[model samples]
Target: MSSARTTPGASHHEDAVGTAADGSGLLTYASLVDGKNVPSDQWVYVVDSDALLQDAFSSLTLKRKLESGRLSPEELPGGSIVGRVARADRETVLQAVEAASRATVEWNAFPLDERLDRFGALLHRRLTEQADRTIEILLREGHPLALARWQVSGALECFSPESLAFYRSQMLHESRHGERRISVRRRPDGVVCLNPPQNAPLSSALLGVTSLMAGNSLVVRAPRSAPLGVMYVLHEIVAPVLEELGAPGGTLNVVCGDPAPMLSAWLDSPLVDDIMYFGSSEAGIRFQERCVAAGKKPILELAGNDTVVVWKDADLEYAAEALTESFYGSGQLCMIPNQVLVHPDVVDRLTALLAEKAADVRGGSVRQEDVLLTPVLRNEKFFACLEDALSSGAELVCGGHAIQDDGTRDTAGIFLEPTVVLVRGLEGARKVQAVRHETFFPLLPVIAAEPAPDAVLLDRFVDFVNSNPYGLRNSVWAGDPEVVEHFVTRITQGGLLKVNDSHIGFLPGLPTHGGTGLTGGVYGEANYPVLRTSHIQGVSISDGGIRPREAVFGAWQAMRGEDGTAAAGA
Candidate 1:
């Protein structure tokens, strides 16, 4: 369903509205609001369910429909909806953002409890009722089922009081000099914008949650590729709560079209205080450069080349199980393992074990499942590296097939099979290192080594993975305690560290979301989402009378409440 946002009140434009689904067949193209199939007549913009909720339903037409509680059956779209978002020029975005900037005063006046309670309800419903649709829409929009579900569902956990209460920790007052001592407090940055990628479109667009919960207005840059999930997830979920919670209207806005104009506008304007970007390291750096030039703070989570190492004392079964994490989603996850380093003693044994269990390592279209992997449709560049490895004498122990020339959605279901290439010796090892680059397909390059020859081989391998420029998640399968301790201490590299388990084990609330190095600027962790988006306000409160007080205490005499342990001197 398409909802018109611009108006002197809502009016209709009838110009033989025709739309196509990303150049795909027309029959499959459906819009959610009106439930109308995109007319096979002319080309138009297509949005998935989530975007329907965010941009469409939340638009003037659908918002009135939902508010009036009279969604017409004739207007209900069939598959999904394709709507028109007039590709606005920079002035449009600036105007809308300035309008929101003016609205922040009233938006910030709402009590935190009431506001959170509203979003909290929406968050709960998101997890409980609409989660399945959220999953289906994400998968339909071209993301792995498990990965998509986790991306959408996991972020839902942020709705509860416990989830965002930490945001208010420093915002509240503490006791000190008989004046209800308020140490530090944080305020919204007025307006914050988010531009998210298409891979996890549903989850990424919600990066606006940072601004929303922090009392700042959020204007999201929704990816045009799969705008459905982002919109619908918001309308069917967040909108109702935001309304009931009494958030000022226009505080949460969405612009659904080419992000180029919108992003450029946001960067050039003084209205936007922060810009959160999620995508390639290259794009992020360039965007950040622009933001810096325009004097705006940009929070980015970019590309990662994670690694997984199997030790001599590792469990073959467990290491094999981790193949799901490294190879699944075609290794598109930022935290997914990019390289698998094997110790010499377990090299042959583990390869054989993997070959036997390789049936579990499968790939197909996003619509299909039990299908553990996806063909790396964009893997031609990586192939040159693979071919160079082969020419340099790397042996192909497993898969080598590439997707066919004319790959349709149906044909693209299965791309390259899970490949295992073993480099000749330590001489060719550099050719297969993830430390150098990343490959987003199910082609695993195994770097073989004989840990039996030296006691430090395992330690050295761990160090190599840790010392790499990328710092996502890296797993090591081993049963040795001393080795675990050594790694746990020395490996301060990846955001998530795994021992004797899969890289996706601590997922959902896991700290594997962000990394540093060429990967991005600031390291990221999911649990620290709120803090990452807001500026810190540290206030030191004492009973007062500094001039009368002769000396200052060197240590804090208090401890954090229910946050686990005490600060060093507390």
Candidate 2:
């Protein structure tokens, strides 16, 4: 394992968990087949300070030398070189998949209670002990420190004892019938491949924790752009616990590299039973089809074009505060509020309030890094999106320009100023590209709804939101309980419904992802990790002589207190 050199700056230390790197500063930690971290001569590149300060997305191959072994690195555009990352090869990835496939049998047979207890303890320990390290990597990746901590800590909190207990309860079935018993069991999906989003690696990586708890072996493909946090959590936090618990070889395996080939390998491999994917709708939909063709289950957390409805009665102060998070992480998050649907009565006031809040957003600052918007690499695409919004009869409210350290207003600069735009009405807003699609920037497009003929303006608003093609999450801000309920019930599109609260934050045990239309694939399935990674089968054991039809009739009669003739008549 080799690279050019470790540039002077912050450094990452391999934890004692299970990470082992060659002396050349290249780190490798995913080929664990049966509780062992198999050493790899192939190196995954880690970007250094020189590469980051350069701001030039150099071909990662520049950092690779002939001595680095057989693996050749490729350069990708539109990402910061936090460091060049070295990753596992195709052979290693397959071995990891096969390992998980083999481990699934014993893992599924493991007692549910014991599995939950042991894994739950590991989650708590890792969160308590290594949280700071996780947060540090997130910050270095340019996430606001507070938000980074939220992502890191939230990942751990998702596996809390209460949540796991709730999931465990769902894993069992109990029924009784006149001297007979029936039980239904939840079985693991065998090998689950977790492909987390690149932007929020830590939280996305932790999404698979419940799958592991469900007794399904895991093969995680860490995002190439930011693999450290995922690797740290896996090797440092998860891998150690598996080893200590005597988990079977091949129970957990991880790999990091380019996604195209890795995805292909996973899709083609018959051993893989399920894929937990967080990615673009196009890729996810294609992958879903292939998974279906192969008889594999695909649990997708796809792109979100989230919409938020603001009723005339909404507390503007509270609504403004919650809605400003649309600009959080430069609006790069999948769950970030993408479009605002405000009643015509409150349009001007809400727009003004939102503009005021957006102006306070800090960008391109050293001391205020925690609040500053991370610089976007795809400046051209961002500008094109901005222009498209403006062309569709949208009026700029507060910010609509880029900010740079050199005062050049270069779009290439790391930060695009938090922007607010107002369109005259829903029709105009719908034509705007920013409103129609997911803008991965701090661009908020507010659309004022025209008054409905009936008194149910809120109902009309709810219908409009429900009509949204993308459905990761949709929120409504209204103080009236009836209005909130009406809106919530009518809107059947999004994976989650938020009322009078921030839309992006997730509750434990509940799904953080899932949706309809473009967001959740054809079936509109919810990507609940514990539920998605397992299947249920009914089990029945009976005393020797009872025939199948008689047993069924007896059970039905016992419950309803009717004889066979009465049951038949009913």
Candidate 3:
């Protein structure tokens, strides 16, 4: 038996376009639109399903046929599609949005404990039975097994009941202002449309849990290229829990389609009150503007160009180990140490250790646990940046070439040599292309900066890191307490700052997404999703909470629906 099923509007050519019972072939994953699985072949007419279908087809000849509208019965491809995915039509999208809007009202009305309990059950399932299933789907999607497990585990911890409670308290709380009693209430912003990036499959759901907890109905559009893992987690793991708890059909709607059209729907529809977008800086800015124009809120998680600083008194070995994470996931991660600023005194030894570590990175299939570096799509961009760095007074200390095979893997995946480039000095690094932009590759640029007096060096490093356009996270390795304190107090660039600790991986209680400049948006602030998607309204309940002169207080009370003729202070 095959895993894929024919839904409405489907035209199946053969059994090859699905996962086999033995788990030998591709899984033509389906979209969950309004709590129902809609297959890719069954996409409605409003969607350009044929175009999407062609993208997944294994044969180039078949792709051309489908593209030119010349695909005949005899010309239909026989082989399985490698990246089969479902694309939702306009009708389905609108239906999901409408259902979400309806569900939002009921969800908000549910008792707080009941809502929390439902989520509690979800967490329990995710950590137990769904744990292995989630990891398998993640592995099938090309994520390393260890990374897949870590992502699932971390996300589970983040959405735990205790974590949610802590986040809620931070977002909203009640207090007394002088003699007046005030209660702060956070209201849902209605339907939130989540558009997560393809790089990290779990980000959408990880963030979406916050909105759901805050009583907002969600319409999450899974990335078309990597929808299987997301769909598996949602449909297989979370959906069952939702059903068991008798959640409304629209309470958590998910769909997959061409991102351009889905983004258009989010911007055009008034039903979507908020759009949580994760992508490049340019596109995120444009989307932010569109959302603002449409009277909707946009929570933007843009690009990151995190940097690390190594002081003279630091442990060079530990620093090298931490810096090696920059090549993890082929440097596709947002928070990995992309650039490092080392003191000239320890620059030589540190660079040597770092180069040796980078060379040891194993390159293999992305699904493999030992393979820390995976194939990157933007080879031209990576090479161009590498060339620019070499030409601009930067010496290639370790790797400077692309390797088809690392003598370990037989897979046909593009592999870039784990590269480490040494810059002449901090001034020279400023001119290097790799230093100018966030190079999302397995390339790290090391700059040697001459340290000044203790106070002066601390200020210089802080300013230097702050000047970088991208700022998701930054870290420093130093033994001096005063130096660490100075770095922490003076640095106002990245959202997260680590002192002599591993820079990768996020904890459950800390702010997960935040930064300044490019890493964050125009109004860059620490992202607390539940708080960002909500507004705080102050309410005062008393017999006479407002007491003022007749000219102003009387009018205010009358406007507030209180009797104007009531006695003073009453």
Highest TM-score model number: 2
| Regions of candidate 3 where Cα sits further than 4 Å from its true position | 2-28, 39-83, 116-121, 175-181, 405-413, 543-570
TM-score of each: 0.76, 0.88, 0.84
**Model 1 over residues 114-188: C-alpha lDDT tens digits?**
555456556666557666766765665556566776676556654545555555564454555443254555666
- Model 1 poorest ten-residue lDDT run: 31-40
Model 3 residue 51 CA deviation (Å) reads: 23
**Candidate 1: deviation at residue 382, Å?**
3.9
| Model 1, residue 498: C-alpha shift (Å) | 3.2
Q: Write the per-residue lDDT of candidate 2 for residues 1-570, one digit (tens) a residue.
A: 332212111123543222233332333344444555454555555554224535535534544442265433332232333333346778788889988888888877778766777677677776777787776666655566767766865776677776777777788887975556888878788889988898787788787867887789998887867777787677667766666676786777777877889878988998988888788898889988988998888888888999988988899988897888888877788888898999888899999899888877665432244464655666677778888888877888977777764334655566677788887776556678898888888888898887765256766777678788898888889878887778877888888888888887767766777888899888675676877888898977767667778665665766555543444335
RMSD (Cα, Å) of model 2: 5.0
Candidate 1 regions exceeding 4 Å error are 1-44, 47-91, 109-118, 157-182, 365-367, 375-379, 403-414, 424-428, 433-435, 450-455, 505-509, 522-527, 540-570
The candidate, 2 or 3, that scores higher on TM-score is 2
Candidate 1 structure, TM-score to reference: 0.76
